[model samples]
Target: MAKYSDEFKLMIVKEYLGGPLGYSLLSRKYGIPDGSIIKKWVNAYKAFGKEGLSKKRSKKVYTVQFKLNVLNFMKQTGASYQETAIEFQMNEPSLIAKWNITFIKEGIEGLKEKTKGRPSMSGKRKPKQSKQEKVISREEQLEHENELLRLENAYLKKLKAFQDNPNAYLEKHKQRWHLNSKKKDLN
Candidate 1:
């Protein structure tokens, strides 16, 4: 579909408001395919006056009041963007982008429009730990295991000496000993 400028739209609305031009003449004048649009604009002007035609027919912008309402809903209810959008019958993506920025800088009050084209709400997280990271993690685990084994070996040697010679075991020793003698069969 083609987009028309607001000026072009206002011209069409003006023509419609002026008099009956039938569907064919109106279609030719505006280069719009359907007569229905002209009829609708006429009806809208009749019911709503010039205010109806003033709005640019495109992606709608939320008013500041509306944005504040949405923000208040978010802060008070702690609703997710999806929930707030759904509750208010708003565009989820647009509402979410606004909600995020609002929460970031000015808290709830900042939900009002800054400039449009804020980035998407859900973006991909950074690439998870690379293969190199995984390999290093495994290496660290192995080193830890080796250290544990060294400590265990030293403990067992001291315990064995204590059991072998009780008198020597009673003398003051630099290192305290722990014996896990349940594994005696392994020795």
Candidate 2:
């Protein structure tokens, strides 16, 4: 697959340097699957500034079948990434990891080879939280308590609803109807 834009890579590198946006957040924010890449970018920026954030060297080949076969073998074997990499005679785990991440984010199509007519970015990076910052606001704290109350209310409501009209709930939802379907077939 192709690499990220220089601008996007610089943006993520800047975010990483600003504190609290660790590799995980950078990965999530930039849609990058590898934490090591973020770390590399951060280091590159420290060493060379914006110029260091340049997209790394890449060698693209028409390997759709190779990638798809790797994906299929991975799914069928449920093997660890390293195992699959070794089996496929791949030199880098990065490609396999990228495929897996793509699969998770999108679907089977993610495993397909990068064609000539694909979009560059699926999404952009999100603003990151700082490490020293508070994890939640007063509004969030209140919401957590409110959610508990709502859950309790829901349970009580369900109990009352069921007690008040069992047949009504059953007839409306029809969860119990499945068990009786076989009985009807026997007759």
Candidate 3:
């Protein structure tokens, strides 16, 4: 959606709190598509007063371990995304939902923070590596090989699990599949 100004959000929230009209009525009056948007505004206003309704100036970066902990907490407690976000003092519940989806699709690797924006440009090109520098050390070669093997093993395990219970796999990830299908349809 539509982005609402902090002033407008505070007005709507105050109207919600002070007036007889409920979420649906206030939403309809303001031309908002969903009453839930107003409900979230009210909840955020209650939790953090005026500050919660304000736009975030900068995106907060979360570590991989912190992301894992958030996911674990939700899984263990069976908390809804909004509840978990509130518990963690996060303004956006959708961020947690995205994290969960990423984790499901690509495992832990997906949770790693990606480099954003355009790559840096340099006017000068770097010198080519010498033959000695280009050659991989035996230990490094073995380590690379081992890592590849580990990735292959994990992939095979997941493949086997999906093969063994395709229905269960589809059931578990039906939402993601549905979203993908919708995108395809749009295309």
Predicted structure 3, TM vs. truth = 0.64
1-187: candidate 2 lDDT, tens digit per residue: 3478888888887777777879987787767887877776666566567765664467756265677788789999998665676676444456788887887788777666555886577577666777557578889889989999999999999889999999898786675687688789899
Residue pairs in clash, model 1: none
Q: What is the C-alpha RMSD of each candidate to the true structure, in Å?
A: 16.2, 26.9, 25.6
Model 1: how far residue 16 lies from native, Å: 2.8
Clashing pairs in 3: none
Highest TM-score: give the candidate number. 3
With candidate 1 superimposed using the best TM-score fit, by how many Å does residue 110's alpha carbon deviate from the native? 24
Which 10 consecutive residues of model 3 have the lowest summed lDDT? 124-133
Candidate 2 weakest lDDT stretch, 10 residues = 55-64
Q: Candidate 3 residues 79-131, lDDT tens each?
A: 99888888888888899999999999999999999998997897777888886
Clashing pairs in 2: 20-131
Whole-model lDDT for model 2 versus the true structure? Answer: 0.74
lDDT of every predicted structure (CA atoms): 0.67, 0.74, 0.92
